[model samples]
Target: SSAVTKNTKIVLNLESLGSLPADEAGPLARYASTIQAQRHDYNGKVLSIRAEDLKSLAIIYDMSPDELTTRLIEWGVLSPGADVASYFDDE
Candidate 1:
């Protein structure tokens, strides 16, 4: 099935993951700290969300797959790369 390979991987920005703003992001949100800066300006974290699951999440949020993908990148949940974003998009 096409599901076996598409939208398989996405990198997350560790710094932004836990700091998603509450007012903007709702339940999974918290205040981000700016005082404790990363030693090497690091935000690297890799998390591969299963394609089906991501698709399901997008559906629940009433957002198109592309929109959700873009939002994830914006929120630092996904790496910022147009190529990466579209690589796994549903056909």
Candidate 2:
């Protein structure tokens, strides 16, 4: 007798709902709803989070503001094409 391992991948889509396995989908949808409920609108952009919002997100992600900022830059969410040095000058 041979045993086979089954693996399932869940991809979340923000634009529209897609077919998802019921067992896993319900929890994911609830989690997404929670996040959506906490979201703040920024200049008409629902997804653009402000620095003040970072306090809550940092607590959730267990990170400091500096760490979160670094991660955001690495993730290409902040300062996508700007040079870091330009933001700071040698004293």
lDDT of each: 0.53, 0.41
TM-score quality measure for candidate 2? 0.37
- Listed per candidate, the RMSD to the true structure in angstroms reads 8.0, 16.3
Expressed as tens digits, the lDDT of each residue in 1-91 for candidate 2 is 1111111111224333224444533443445556567764222222433334545555656776556546545544445333322222221
Over 4 Å off, model 2: 1-46, 80-91
Per-residue lDDT tens digits of candidate 1, residues 1-91? 6444344465445556667776655522221122124233234353343455556556756787678777877787776553344544446
Query: What are the clash counts of all predictions, listed in order?
Result: 0, 0
Cα misplacement distance, residue 85 of candidate 1 (Å): 4.8
TM-score of each: 0.54, 0.37
Whole-model lDDT for model 1 versus the true structure? Answer: 0.53
| CA shift of 41, model 2, Å | 7.6
